[model samples]
Target: MSSEKQMKVEAVTAPVDLGEGPHWSVKEEALYYVDIFNQNVHRYHPISGNHSRMHIEGGPVTLVVPHAKVSKTFIVTVGRDLAVVTWPDPSKDCVITSYKVLSSVDAQCPDNRFNDGKCDRKGRLWAGTMGATDVPDNPNPHLGSLFIMHNDAKVTKVVDKVSISNGLAWNVKNDTFYFVDTCEYKVESFDCEFLRGVLSNRKTVYDYKTSGLHPSFPDGMTVDTNGDLWVACFGEGKVHCIEPSSGKVKKDVDLPTNSITSVCWGGPQLDHLYVTTTKKGLSKEQLLAQPLAGAVFRVTGTGSRGYPATECNVSLPK
Candidate 1:
């Protein structure tokens, strides 16, 4: 297998138990990510080289997006509920009381919990779900699903029977939406009607399982300005830039750890690729080999750029 190599990558911080869900704050000039197993939300300032985390008491925070209207507020998926939370001040201890629950998921699938999510250009929160870890051995992965939380406080089920819903991205034109169900080992695309937040014409854009080029599955993803999709390869320690139309791998950037989980583009010009990895399931020997397993990394000089993240404007009932 051939790989396109041009970007330079490096670790920027120490590792977290499960460093996932990376989000770039253009306004704050900071990067935010979550430590899923630790139930913590972290903030990192690249220039200052400072890092801090706030504890989420009851359940883990799967993903977080900036509020569309409020500068210091955010919309996040906490456990099986949707919430509006304030960005914690790094100078003070993060208080759990700052979060307000806006919506709770279906009680029918109590084993299900929210996983990866972000706001569409229309400011709607599109998030996916997965089975809770507490379930019995090898729980029903098919129980997972994807959902849309609208700006008007309405919730709709978009896709069902999904297992381990992970990465989500949209083309620069906003006409196509890409999704990843990690267990399926493929990145799927759908025709997206942005105004109404409707998706149709589902098709596979790329299949890692069939490609046999890598030993990992696709996790988190982001789209570039040139319309290529950059996806993190869990257990493979690399991120790939793929051409969506042809479903071909155009480029790949290797990392120091094997469990890379997610990626986002930030920096003033949106040229920096920030990545997150995990240290969750490594054996003693494996951990020793990848001491930076759960740390966050950044890749620069990639000759590509990404679109800005749309803020979450969905209104939550007080």
Candidate 2:
């Protein structure tokens, strides 16, 4: 574990309204993420310090995953719809050349929208939705559900009655699935069956309420090569590395601002940790005090490495 003094944390992009998902694409040798409120997808190349964004004009773009078999195409969740997007050039800011909606969920709840998501090693996408957060920092509870998008483009509901479906990760062995429902304030694990795309043996791995880390919400997360979980603490402004087996906090990496949204591993060796944050809901005083609230940050010298992000293998509609 790298101490706060030894860890290197640097802002990598200009502040956005809300920065959420941070994914490192090994193939492109770049980092990809989304600005939900701004309705855009951004790509940042660490080597050249070049950053570009594509305006997603449908709705709030929650997450973006590269397609396993298609180049320049991706699987993204725009509002309640699971969609496909094509980005012809990533070196410059541009509009998506093509867009297609595969399916939409929460038809009965007009305010429900997709939140956090990621692909399994098998290239299956697992994403969840959250009820409207009309009230600042308070999302409607129990209206969300988790779903899996298979390779055939089939969508199936896996878990129901969720509140603020947030961070998600799968273990190195691909047999355990870890998740977070922000409202619950706990990290839960599930026994995974990749072939059938099902989860069982649900158990709480870490409880924030009891861990003395209150007033903070567990948001985005990722697993390191050692199978430990790195969870972003939204209000706490830190990332806690937890050992899944013992559910113990192995280490903590503090950020300069609150409202930390997500984290991912980048760099050629997958040893750099990339973090995202949001400026939404901040007051004039809070904004003044936290100028870097919405900027993307990169932390290195954590003494750990992460696995390459798995691309979505879902076949697009012909």
Over 4 Å off in model 1, which ranges?
1-6, 88-92, 133-139
RMSD of each: 2.2, 1.6
Error of 1 at 313 (Å): 0.8
Q: Alpha-carbon error at 180 in model 2, in Å?
A: 0.5
**What number of backbone clashes does candidate 2 have, counting pairs of residues 3 or more apart or in separate chains?**
0
Q: Residue 5 lDDT in model 2?
A: 63
User: Least lDDT summed over 10 consecutive residues: which range in candidate 2?
Assistant: 132-141
122-147 per-residue lDDT for model 2 (tens digits)? 89889999998822246468888999
Alpha carbon lDDT of residue 75, candidate 1? 78
Clashes of 1: 0
